[model samples]
Target: MPELLEVEYFRRLAERCAGRTILHIDVPDAHALADGRSPRSLRQAVVGRRIELARRHGKLLVLETDGPALGLRFGMTGGLVVDGELAIDRLLYSPGTFGTAWVRFGIRFDEGELLFHDPRRFGRVSLDPDESRMGPDAMAVTAAELGRALATRGPAPGPALKARLLDQSAIAGIGNLLGDEILWRASLAPSRPARSLAPAELRRLHRHLVATLADLLERGGSHTGDLMAERHLGGRCPKDGSPLERSTVGGRTTWWCPRHQH
Candidate 1:
């Protein structure tokens, strides 16, 4: 499956690729496309009107059109076409990252539809009014609102690390890949009791989250969120190497150097 980056990443990509408005929206498998809306229908929905914004929240990619918003998910195999040209082939994308963007690609009157090619058709495209009211995303939630949401979810930060990282209401832009990376870096056992984390451990985990994300975003936050991986499944750990181990945590592939993670 092609990695599905958080919407914020896509949104940033979309926003940067400003010009030649989105001529058409294509989504083969999406809840919004429920009941079936033809590609023609999608074309009619957004042929003109400046792309007010393009963003990603969680795994959802949103392109806020002057008229309606376009939302997309890259499922297992999906990509974007600018000006009717498929440029995804030129990029050496990482595992945790997916979708299309040239660091910053734009054009004026490019006058071509943004094509989403997904062989499996597991992804979808849709039009909406308010983007904030979406799923598995925290774009709409304010910092304070997110804090309140976290408080309600419980401050015990260790037990359900997976749930916490995947929770859209908690912190945006984190998915399975990032969650595993963060946990591995912090040395907080994946299945450890959330509340059982020592104060120092909790602090360490929080710092890792900030530091890790900050560093990646500096590189444009591609579909692959882990910088250490650099596209390979196995590599020498930055901290230590004893043949990095790979496992399934919360149903997602996870990797860590046993010598350093503990």
Candidate 2:
């Protein structure tokens, strides 16, 4: 799946389309349209408008045009291909090869083209997607913002720490892999209660969260995290010589070093 790092790459690739006028749009799969949008409605939105900029919020990519903004959500296996250049060479769990039949949507510019390729058809395209629902971008989130997001309001323990991290409404751009990596690096347990953290722990969590995202973005993608290799059945922790533990946290597979992450 394309996480924050991968989506950032897609945003960079989309920058190629900036200042280019849309000559045509190819909606080979109407199911790719999101928010109950139809092909005709999509065409009516931005057929001949000029792409002014490419922006990203969490996993959503938005192409600001002279007219309406175009939004893209690359579900699990979707990718961006601009002028035959792929934003990412390959995605984990995605097919190794590219097929023409997988192109769900496309845009023909005056000079080149951009293709939204997704074999599973889980990707979506929308016009003027609502960005207000999402929290702050994970890459730029402040410690205060994170504190507010994780602050417990009642006597309830609240959601698990990992669940809070994975919540796009609380902190945008964090997916399964990044959540585990950040928790592991911060030496925090995934199943810890959201409200259990002290001020110091919150600072540590914020530090690792920002650092992990930056490190992964520089390395390549979310799959390149340090804890990625030890996410399996018999995998051992790279930090200590202890056996890694695996379980379901926040409805997603989670791995952590029981010896170090407390």
Among the numbered candidates, top lDDT falls to 2
Off by over 4 Å in 1: 1-13, 16-35, 40-44, 84-110, 129-159, 168-170, 198-200, 217-237, 243-245, 257-262
Clash tally, candidates in order:
20, 0
- After best superposition, candidate 1 residue 6: deviation in angstroms? 8.0
Clashing pairs in 2: none
Model 2 over residues 1-262: C-alpha lDDT tens digits? 8898999999999998999999889999999999878888898889999999999999999999999999999998999899999898877867667788999999999989999999888999999988898999999999999999998576787899999999999998999999999999999999999889999999999999999999999998999998888788899999886899999998999999999998
Please state the error at residue 146 of candidate 1 in Å: 7.8
Candidate 1 local accuracy as lDDT? Answer: 0.53
**Segments of candidate 2 deviating more than 4 angstroms:** none
Q: Tell me the whole-model lDDT of each prediction, alpha carbons only.
A: 0.53, 0.92
lDDT of 2 at 130: 87
